[model samples]
Target: MPLIRYRTGDLGRLLTEPCGCGSQFCRLDRVKGRIAFRSALPSVYDLEELLYGMDTVLDFSARKEENKLCIQVLLAEGGTIGPVREAIEARFPDALVSVSSTLCLVSTGKQLIN
Candidate 1:
C-alpha cells in the first residue's frame, strides 16, 4: 500500500511553495529537530515492527559500549522519561530497560541499561 500523508500531532507551519521532490503534498519547512529526540521511549512491539517504525525514528541506530536493548527517541516537550520506561518494561517484561539523557557526542542515542 502507498504511504499516505497524515498529521502526526507535530504542529508546525507549512510551506506554500511546492517541494523540490515534486510532491504536491504541503511540505513543512521546519518542524522539531534533533534536540527533541533526546527523551523518546520504547513501544510494545516485536523487533520486526520496531525495525519497521525506525524509518521515522530519529537517531535509532547508534554505537554503544555496553550490550543491551537500546531504543532511540525524539520526544515532544513536557514528555516525561518515566512513562516511557514504564511502557517499555510493561511491554517487554522479560527485558531490562534503562534510560539515559542525551550525550553531546551521541546526540540522540539510546542505551537500554541492562
Candidate 2:
C-alpha cells in the first residue's frame, strides 16, 4: 500500500532531520495561519462550525473601535488567536473583527485581529 500526499497549501517549514525526542518522522513547524490569504475566510454557511473549531476561544465582546468592529476573544489558550481571527471573518463577512494586544479583562489568553 502507498500513502497519498495531499497538498494543503500550508505555509510552514518541513523538518527533514530526526527529532531530539527520538521520532524519525518529518515534522512540520510553525503551522501558522491559513494556507492562502484568499482562503482565510470560510463560507457563511460553515461559519458556526468555524467559530467553534477553535479550542482556546471562550467568549467574545464586540464593539466599534475606531470605526472597526473590534472583538476580544476570551481564550483558554493564547495560541489559538489565528484560527479565531479567521473564523470570525468567515462568520461575519460584513463585519470586521480586530483584536487588541491587551488580553480581555477576564484573563490573558488568545486574541484575534482582522
Candidate 3:
C-alpha cells in the first residue's frame, strides 16, 4: 500500500537542497523529535534514558499490572530494587510502582503505557 501526504511519526526536517556531490535526492535533518509518544506518560526513549542511566540497572521493563505501573528489573552487583522503585515513584508520584522478577508482561514488544 502507498501512503500519500502521510505523517510518518518521525521527527526531522526535509532537506530539498541538492547535494554538494550533485546528488538530486533530498534528505532529512537530525531528529527534531516526535509527537508525544503516549499522551498519559513519557516517551519510550525518555524512559530508557532514565532507567539506563542508572548504575545498578542491568535491564528493565516498564509495564502495568493490576491497574498500576510496575517495573521489572535485572540488577547488577547485587543491587536492590528499593532504590529503583523509589526513583521511579519519585518521578511518577501517583503511579503504583512495584518490583518484579525479570518475567515482565510485554505487549506489542514495547513499553505498555496507556
Name the best candidate (by lDDT): 3
Give the poorly placed runs of model 1, Cα more than 4 Å off. Answer: 1-67, 94-114
Note the Cα lDDT for every prediction shown: 0.38, 0.49, 0.56
Score every model by TM-score.
Answer: 0.29, 0.35, 0.50
* Cα TM-score of candidate 2: 0.35
How displaced is residue 48 in candidate 2, in Å?
9.0
Query: Looking at candidate 3, what is the lDDT of residue 102?
Result: 61
Model 3, 1-114: lDDT tens per residue?
Answer: 222222223245567889889989976554433223234445444555677888988766555454455556667877887887777777755555544456443453533333
Instruction: Give the distance in Å from residue 34's predicted Cα in candidate 3 to where it truly belongs.
Output: 12
Candidate 1 C-alpha lDDT tens digits along 1-114: 122222222234667688888988876543331121123333222332443343333322222224334554443455554665565456545334333344223222322211
Candidate 3 Cα misplacement greater than 4 A, ranges: 1-39, 105-114
Q: Sort by TM-score, best first.
A: 3, 2, 1
